[model samples]
Target: MRIALCALLLTGLLVFPGVLPNSPGHLGSLAETALPWFGLGVPLLLVWAAVRRSVKEVTCVLVPAVAWVALFWPGIVDFGGRDLGRADFRVLTVNVGGDRTAPRDVARRVRATDADVVALEKVPGPAMHAYEKELGGRYPHHAVGDTLGLWSRYPLRGVEKLDLGGAWPHAVRAVARTPVGDTAVYAVRLPSVRVGLGKGFTVQERDASAARLARRVADDGTPRVVLLGDLNGSLRDRGLAPLARELRSAHRQAGEGLGFTWPAAFPLVRLDHVLVRGLDATGSTVLPDLGSDHRPVVTGLRAAR
Candidate 1:
């Protein structure tokens, strides 16, 4: 028991680097949601050490306990207190649960945000008409690609489909003629990751797709670019390192809290995101659930000078 606890302590200190041979696999990616909870194991070992009255065991437990605190303390405490200089406009992204989520409910939430642009994924053919009718009045310009769609108050130009190695059109790009300037917006939905005993973690497709998306974003010459939708991988995941290096997450810069936005009932992981390049994020936050499993992510941005 002492040896096992000591090993657990050491693992916590290592922070689960991705290159390790026995690394948690798909489990590692999902494990991030409950990273802080791993610290709870340290207390159990401490108590066991106390009962055994073993000095060595107590000393070992301290290593992991301290390591866990050092790693997660910043994430737990909100450091999101920057005075958003001047927001030009806001964008909201939501996965409207295909045909399951009522169009009226989704439309109500979109109306509530009053965002300049709105991006939705998993939009079904059956519910397309309803959304068009409900959002058409407020947002005059709109485009749909496969199951994804974007609605904008500004004029949409140079609309094009984006193929991120998906069989269907899961991504599209358009130039929004805003009051300040024309901004490139990409609404995308990456392939979902799966976990199974045989495959352990299934994200090779998602990773490949992410790489393609990163390449496209890097190649874009637009002065201002914004990506809105479900990438299925969080900013922290190494698989998303390419995109992470090229784009900046709004939540990291201006969100007021942890900014988690999945399983809206009790968000554990942030699968949805608003990432930008050549623009400054003034404010970012998660909105209340719109009768969908994933909550909406909204961000205010300013064109970078």
Candidate 2:
């Protein structure tokens, strides 16, 4: 029984979600999203093996244990602080929760990072004025559309709304003329996903939106590009494969730990991301909560010459 359990856990960790059936609530995608958590089973199985005094079972536990370490140990290690000072610029992205009442506080905490660029999502219509008032002095060049906004210290031009096949504007693109060069910055908020008894993990809509966003990014001719926003899905999930194929995640490149940034109180999973192309990620950090449901993700980047 212990051997069987270990084998199952190993298969789940090693198998790509695409190979598994996605029907009945996107089971494959759901498993992939929480992939790292599967390691918990290792401890539980070990305890069970001890209780049963089964030598074979105890040895079998090593299978999943090795697999988990091989798959996730690198991402969990800290390897970023040293290169942070070399970064050319810093960018921050956060989903300030539509219902947040402290826009000024949010803006203040974000500004404290001194990020060269800031991307905000889910800004309530009424609170827009507060954000502008608080962040305008620091980030003079800014753009706002629908629920998404971008603020930059550098001059911004060619600001446009991207059509992600959504009725309301959920993405905006602009060019920031930085000291390094012109970098296309995209502030995006992908559709949210939910899991219910009836629907296992409803991610179809989010996947479709991701496909559209990927196409838009692919079409852009800009050599340096930075994408910041609440992706609503982790990089491990297959739904984000479209964007994952073309861009590199800043956290995976330079962040320490798993970098979870949601449910500000406990942050179990990372729904926010800073993805870049034609640039190197020097460092990444998840900032403290500033009265928003989601914590902000800041990444230091250096434009590749």
Candidate 3:
């Protein structure tokens, strides 16, 4: 009976996480954000069944194990195929946090990626000058709006601030003229979410901001678009479903492993993403830490002609 109950609990969390209540605490959203980690319970259950010497319990354990594999196996495997030729462009995005020291070092590390485009968020106003100075030589074209910034090796045009229902601008949009063609790029930093003993999961502001951002992206006329930012929530979180439906996550398409990028010292969840549309993602990876709370994500893309 203990094994049966354990199996049911694991399966329910894996397959029906959405059914969990969101009020008081946003349990459902939290489950979805940490969904992949829940697979760890499968082995524990299997061990318990083995000790009990019950074949029935062992079979029950297989139920959740299968469900976990079916849901996340694709993300774990690298099925991006062999040698998709050279990537037309590479993009990198990172939330540099509010660190006052070593901003230059951070800029140097990011520059070493050799990405055609770079997006940075949570950059304090004063540190902007430092980044501009360090990145200016490599990326001649750039734009900065509030804490969000975009730097490109290609010429950038139509630079503008995006209002995602925030008091200050936290998003920016620009067009980059690359050899392949023009592509619209967005640099965004959605509102942060908090979970406290008293408040539970506080994501109301982030959810509203995500909705506004989704609407703006939908209205955009550009056929090719690349969104780079710290979304503050993973793709599995319902708050991001609107944008998730509109864009394809580069990591999911080409990356191996879970690609967690937050709390850089001991990464636990993926808060940064490189999402695209009208482009083929050839490769995606999380870069080494650069003195920030969040790590950087890089993706290789080719125009989907």
Candidate 4:
């Protein structure tokens, strides 16, 4: 019985990858929504093995234990990033949770970052004025469409709304004339997904929205592109695979630690991202929670010379 139990635990550990939340199917949503929690199983299994004190059983458990660490240790530890010198631009992305977060406070926190560009999502209609007034001096150039907005210190041009197969446009594109060159920036907010007993993490809409966003990104002619937004899904989720293939996630490339940014009180998953192409992210990180459900993500990107 001891050996049999150890074998069962080992099988689960080895096969965990098969259950990773990387696809658009229903099963994938459950896995994606709770991807981080999967690591806890390793500790639980370890405790069980120690309690049994069977030499053979404990030895067998080591296989799955090593596998778990191999898969998740990188995220758990802050491997740090290379010193790429000064960055040309600093960008901040945040979902201010509509009325749940105060616009003045949000603007104040953003100002503190001294970001070159700020992308905001879930801006309620009434709070627009407050944000505009609060962010005016710092960011001279601004664009707003539906729930998405972009505030930039640099000159913004050709601002256009993007239709991501939603009721209203939830994304906007603009060109920022920076010291390095003209860089295309996108402020987007993909449809939210649910993780519950009903639909079991419904992501059909999010998947479609991601697909549309991916096509738009691919068609963009800009040599340098930066996408800032509340992606509503983690990088591990396969629905965003198209975008992932086209761009590099700053958090994965240069961030410290896991960089999770949702449920700000205690972020367990990363639903926000800064994805870039043709630019190098010198660093990426999640800022301290600013009274919103989603914590902001800040990244420094250097335009290619």
Residue-level lDDT of model 3, residues 151-229, one tens digit each, is 9999999999988786888689999997668899999999999989988888888889888888888888888899999
Give the clashing pairs for model 4. 22-238
Q: Which candidate should be chosen as best, given lDDT against the real structure?
A: 3
Give model 2 RMSD, 1 decimal: 1.6
> Between prediction 1 and prediction 2, which has the larger TM-score?
2
Give the C-alpha lDDT of model 1.
0.81
For all candidates, the clash counts are 0, 0, 0, 1
Write down the TM-score for model 3. 0.95
Between which residue pairs do clashes occur in model 2? none
The digit string of per-residue lDDT tens for model 2 on 1-305 reads 84667656565666544677778789888888888777888888889888898888888887778888877788787644536667899999989988874888788788888899999999998888889999999999999998899999999999999877757876899999976799999999988899999888989878999999999999989889999999899888999999999899988888878888888999988899999999988888898887789999888899864
Clash pairs, model 3 backbone: none
Candidate 2 at residue 114, lDDT? 80
**Residue 78 C-alpha lDDT in model 4:** 63
What lDDT would candidate 4 get against the real structure?
Answer: 0.83
CA RMSD per model (angstroms): 3.0, 1.6, 1.6, 2.7
Give the worst 10-residue stretch by lDDT in candidate 3: 77-86
lDDT of 4 by residue, 237-256 (tens): 77778889889898777786
